[model samples]
Target: MKRSLSLPGIAYGGDYNPEQWPEEVWAEDVRLMREAGVTLVSVGIFSWALLEPSEGVYDFSRMDRILDLLHANGIAADLATPTAAPPAWFFRAHPEALPVDRDGRTLSYGSRQTFCPSSPAYREAALRIARELARRYADHPAVVMWHVHNEYGCHNAECHCDTSAEAFRAWLRDRYTTLDALNEAWGTTFWSQRYHDWDEILPPRATGAVPNPTHRLDWRRFCSDALLALYTAERDVLREAAPLTPATTNFMVMHNFDALDYWRWAPELDIVSNDHYLRSTDPESEIDLALSADLVRSLAGGPWLLMEHSTGAVNWQPVNRAKRPGELRRNALAHVARGADGIAYFQWRAARAGAEQWHSAMLPHAGTDSQIWRDVVRLGADLKALSQVRGSAGTAEVAVVWDWNARWALELPSQPSEEVRYLDTVRSWYEPLWRSGVAVDFVRPDADLSAYRLVLAPALYLVDDAGAANLTGFAERGGTLVVGFHSGMVDENCHVRLGGYPGAFRAALGVRTDELFPLLPGETLGLTGEVPAGASATLWSERLRFEGAEVIAAYADGPLTGVPAVTRHGWGAGTAWYLATQPDAVTLAALLDRIRTEAGVEPVLDGIPEGVETARRRGQDADYLFLIDHGGRGAELRVPSGATELLTGERIEDGVLTLPPGEVAVVRHPR
Candidate 1:
């Protein structure tokens, strides 16, 4: 069934914890929120202590009043199950719920998510609380969604206790089935670490030295599965009472919680939700956030929620930098441009005490008249005015392939170059198209590539026969293919494919690599053709030999000097480009520009300066243009001459629309 939300216009507002404040402040908060046009409020986060002050005792009186007030004030609610942290009374009664660290020390509740996921006592207690919450409030028309646990994963390298050890063994047995199979998979014969029994297998821990990388990798996979099992158990219980309500858990972008596979977790979720934070100064931050957004959209194959974002600066990082004047508004627009169905900040009210006390909030304890509060209010008004244009936005024509199994297979390799990071390579390919205002959809490896004119696969280190066939088929049918180094070397099982490098893709790419020149850090290599400045040639550079391809650029210097750095292979009516070295941003951008022209790909907007992003989504009766100003200086954007700015009701038929820093314009052209 297709899922949809009731709240209109990019569900605005954020995490609101009014329970901590006195009732006297309720009226003021409601006024401030309504003034900002804030429509949705996420309540009950981090409220386990308030909800269950004592074991076997439940209290929702405070939460009830908060929700009632929000609903009465015309605000929708996304109620969270306050199960992120258990109450101290429950922990004291059931000490077994504590998670043990890798060094075998049991953890105490100094922070949230301290409970062990595999603990039976913890699961039972958490389910009881979730069931109670759903039963009591499932019928509330104001409640739109159920937020399970807040960011469900371990924060540190822990959970190596006895319970985890037992769970690890069970997880392995289900995966490998036999001791010999496990031994072979992990290559346990090396270092005389062959396991004689399933009992011998232990979870990865700091206490013991990791002599085998394969074993450590497997343990990571096992740990992720264990947590997924816990999440699934909780979700099942919630579905029993509120079967109609969508259940979701917030995810941190590119977070590696023992390699928890989000692709595997997507189907179980009603809508993918994530927290994206990027400063305004960073050039690639917006693109990075877009990658994460595309990743979630591809995982769910639909629109997702922007669960949490810093309204300004975050207090956690070593550098606490606030968003400059118009930065917050720009970031919000960027989210909508990338297919976000809802936008919510991390916090509503600033914390008066605790670790997050210094973090920025919509309404600081200093009150709602502050500069940050006013900015949020203005942005909220813009969002409310644009709500009528909801679901009438940009659509992506190009799809970038994102495969979880391939990502896992690449990372699992025991000897792959450490410099070939997955996320970094993916970003390298994505940023060029993003800056060029290309609407990109992150598609799974199995998705149909025919819809896209260009398909890019960066550091696709693992390629099964089926995936290889898909790529080859796409190219054979006149689709342009762009691939990067270290790709097509291994299979799904992390085993090297024989015959040659890029085993299954040798014929499709029209190239074969005989040797790889592993370049050390600070190594310099020049390209024969025009190259981008500041591009690092680090990591292992492959010395290539083309079978039926022409070299576009060769290394200008080095031992493999004058060898192929980039090659183009003609396959049927289309062509494929194999990049053997990481080029600088300028060179990469130029290369992408050339490819776009050759493939007849049209940009949504042309000649936009750096920090400005543009995207277009068209429906049967309307065309929506999402213009975001990422630049620090306000600039005039040349809208398509006759479009009208939907947010401000301004006509752009004869002149350019001037957008301030971090400002967004949603222009609609009625058909």
Candidate 2:
């Protein structure tokens, strides 16, 4: 009884909210589902109010009919625990369960995810509902997977209420048994914030000034763990009731979500799934999608599912821009190309009323006659044609270190420059690699880098002892490593590493910087030597005394003009390069190009037109080369001798395939 037994090739369909519609519409839902080739539907995700009208009174009658209809129509179910949204009755009884904001305002129950993660009443009631749900339908034939608690920590990542304070104390006690250890770790002597008693410490509510960085850091960690505890409690109940079915919670791994350290959370789940939507503000949101997909695939170490996306516009942004025609197909295929086994949207049908009423879905409000609906049907067929690539894995020869701990430390209230955004710096390095057609995988700093030929650490401002050693060892063991500005400045405690800049990696990089001279607003500087022509720098520069390293580039005109802006060192059998300042796009791309050649890393395909996205996922029998013309350029590439393009059924014997602008091709060749 394997969990994969029920998967219909690449599982299709999205969140099916039968609870939102009447019974009569459910019949139409099933008919349309079959017509669209849907194989699965996530049921009852936010149905606690419908299922549990009153305390100790359970109703499974409605859910029974929904599951029956779905099963009768040959659609599998990703059954949910319904713990994300606690019933209004439960909140009315235990009003203290509502989360309190940092400004001491109690969040009302009108919005979703109103319950505090640390509330005992919430934990008990959520577990009970999960237990009851499992008892009723765990053995049902339609239940293929158990989805426990939707999007944990999406809204209330932290709470400052009394119950949370108590739980925080308990968590801290477990982390640091004594008051002295807690004081030492948090560095409380700076502003007379040392704790003599464990209960004396409280959540950093709104104060006159910024709170301790270490305190904020630890609280972030505790918040992630608190929600994780809720997920595990429900997951255990579902696991006991249904031993064969796997359980997962959709992760928000896109640019905006940084609350949860997914590395700590990914190992606890049976599958790694993520919900990603287009950041409509960015013109090239597809690159953001690629970054998120690669991160999820790396977390799973193989294939994963695209839990939720949008067919068109999302309702949340200030100006929700709709996806243009053909953008939908390209987005879905890009996820699959990066290693998504299945593609799904936020919901199956558009909501006529609700907070997210305007969010797009599989079946738009305009019905099947619309372009969105047609694209959905076409994408479903294309996924079925890609059934052979379900377990296939991406071939990422390069790795980039992306850690939440460092990110949290970097974004603290006080820093060199407020403009040195964390995600922006990471993306600056990743974009060039994507443009070059190379596959990239995001990794934790201490993860085994032996597999990759090149590793990039952009704006990795924080590093602990183990992480520092792992990075330095990779460079010493013949793996080329690149570190960006402001990295290795502090230890895990947010305490500066004392003597020089980049304390943790100074020895490995063979460069020493006494201080940092971050640029002012609207400032820019030029660089010369071993870099692309007209290479400019911005945001940051440092007093680099690169005595032991070779100066690859130097500031041509700035405050620290003529200083070593970029340096390289041959440490042991490998190489370590450091960029003292953030270089412009062309310079960074040229730098990566030189590094790739030196490290012997190759892109998925070479000599392709610019703006075309490329990725190769290798199955046991064949390698699928995904060529997506995201750049809107007609292009040609040399294909394998007898490769066949899956999308159009075109055979290639002359070893060349030409693609028109906005076209997509999946070329299959021997693995």
Candidate 3:
């Protein structure tokens, strides 16, 4: 039952929608797919309208033919349930199926994922399609895996409709059981908002007054749960019908539009797959991409799928700038470097019409003569050549704790400052690690920390008593722990831990916060003690008192200049470090450098160039080292003397390796 990629090497094609083209075009498309070394194609996504034009009617004739053609061409199929976008007729028949936004306005049918997760009608329809697809393609030679509804809750994660309100109430009842418990947990006595009955509760809609923080927190949890329920319903049907074919729903990793707790969903899936789209705003899109891939691999506990990414410019961004000459290849290899079993795009051919017509694909609208097509073909060949990477697992000695609950709690109406964004701050802290070539795995706060040498909780603002004990246990058991500012400040209910700031972690961290002095947008305080001479603190600062911990760095020049900015405490057999303010990049990197050195955490590869990224994939007998040069310059890299470069089959006995600009190399070292 080790569920994994069914294909031999990295499954290299992408979303192939043959139904959109004429019947005559399919054969040529298949021919081109073969030429491009397409091992797998995800078919039938968003094809519900064509499959079942009316209620209880499914014509799989064309779908069957497409599968047969793919089979004939020796290409595997990742068959989708086509439930992402239900037919327009189904919406006309059951208008209640539509989702309502925060303002309580019903979203129309024309867009994808328009259905409300809590709507019984929508669930019934989605399940029917899932069951049908499972039944028909269970034993098909071409179908290797079942792709569940595309990007669950991408657009409709939260709804303010009556159905959702009722669902939220039911969820709350299940969680709290009694009105007394609910009232206590929500702190309803604060604003005379105590609930005597479940019927009084409503979804947090757009209103002049801010909703209860606990209420909003629970609502976000419920919304994620409701969507997960829909995905589970479909997944169960597919599991029952096609037990052998692994089922997966493509997750939009760290996508702002959806808030589904992937940790909860990971257990239900046989294999984890994710759709990662690079943000245009991020200058370090490569690092962000690697972070997301590592997260998906961690969720699977093994290699996962890069189910969807753009080949070039995506249509959704405000300014859709096409990727430069070698960018696509770099992006694809980056995912593979992390631990992607498959390298796929959002689409095969560019759409001719509709909302995503301009979204770049493996094959553009200009046909196979373009540079994008040439890159696609080259990537496919490269993957085929480096097939040894399949089934390899990415190894990381450091784990960063991530929690959707903390994210929701941090974004609540009342907090320290609007500048403290959760994931952004986490990535900012992670940037130094990534730059230093450290492999990272994102884990839950409650996840077992014994596997990691060091654990960093970046803005883990919300935690339960159990979570607090978990981190403390990690430190006591000889694991180095780093707690950022604002962490452990509140409980699961968004209530302050009143004895002092950073209440839950106080005993473990051996530090107490007196007061929080949040800096303005452009303000910064210079550092003096323990830290590099002239290092500055920005965004936030806390006047901290060392209960038992030794001061690491102290603020140099401000109202709290004499106080400690950073502190480290030696507990049991391990040490715990705390940052009382947001450190600048140089300081953060310097801090991590010390931590890394102390924890005995070494980079995957030594002497890696500044802009070159390195990731190691471990196999039974050897390891594959992936080096990607995003610096646009060539560099000489050191490798194991006897290792062989897989892509070029060159022996590196001298241990000196050269990487060209925008190129990639995978070196295999025998264990």
- lDDT by residue for model 2 over 10-91, one digit each (tens)? 8888999977887799989999988888998888999998889999899999999999889999999999888888888998
Q: Tell me the tens digit of each residue's lDDT in model 3 across 1-671.
A: 54555778888889998888899999888899999999988999989999998999879999999999999989999999898899999999999889999897999988899988899998888888888888888988999998988998888888899999999999999999999999999999997898888999999899788789999999989988998898888888987987777888898877564488888988888889999988887777898888888888989888888899999989988888888779899999989988898988979989898899999998899898899999999988889988888988878999999898998898888687988888888888888888888999988988988889999998899999999889978989999999999999889998889988778889888999878999999899998776676799889998789999998888888899789989899988998999888988898899988997899999998788799988899999999999998888978999999999988899999998999888899999998
> Which is the winner by TM-score between candidate 1 and candidate 2?
2
Q: Give lDDT tens digits, candidate 1, residues 1-671.
A: 43457776778989888877788988888888898888888889789888877876878898888888888999998888887878888788888888888767888986888887778888888888888888888888779888888887746324787787888888888888898888877777777889998887777667444446666656666766777777777777877877777878887755333256676777878878887777444655777777777777667666688889988888877787887777777777777766777888979889888888888888866676678888898888777766655665346767777776566666653454655667777777789888898888876665778778988877777777788878877888999988888787776555677877666677777888877776666666777754554443556577688899888777877888777788889888888888888876677788888887788888887778887888776656877788887666667877767778978888898758888776778887776
Which candidate number maximizes lDDT? 2
The predicted structure with the larger lDDT, 1 or 3, is 3
What pairs collide in candidate 3? none
Give all candidate RMSDs, comma-separated: 2.6, 1.2, 1.2
Question: In model 2, which runs have C-alpha deviations exceeding 4 angstroms?
Answer: 1-5
Which stretches of candidate 1 lie above 4 Å from their native place? 154-158, 207-211, 255-258, 279-284, 404-416, 530-536, 634-636, 660-662
Cα displacement (Å) at residue 35, model 3: 0.8
Per-candidate local distance difference test: 0.77, 0.90, 0.89
TM-score of 1: 0.93
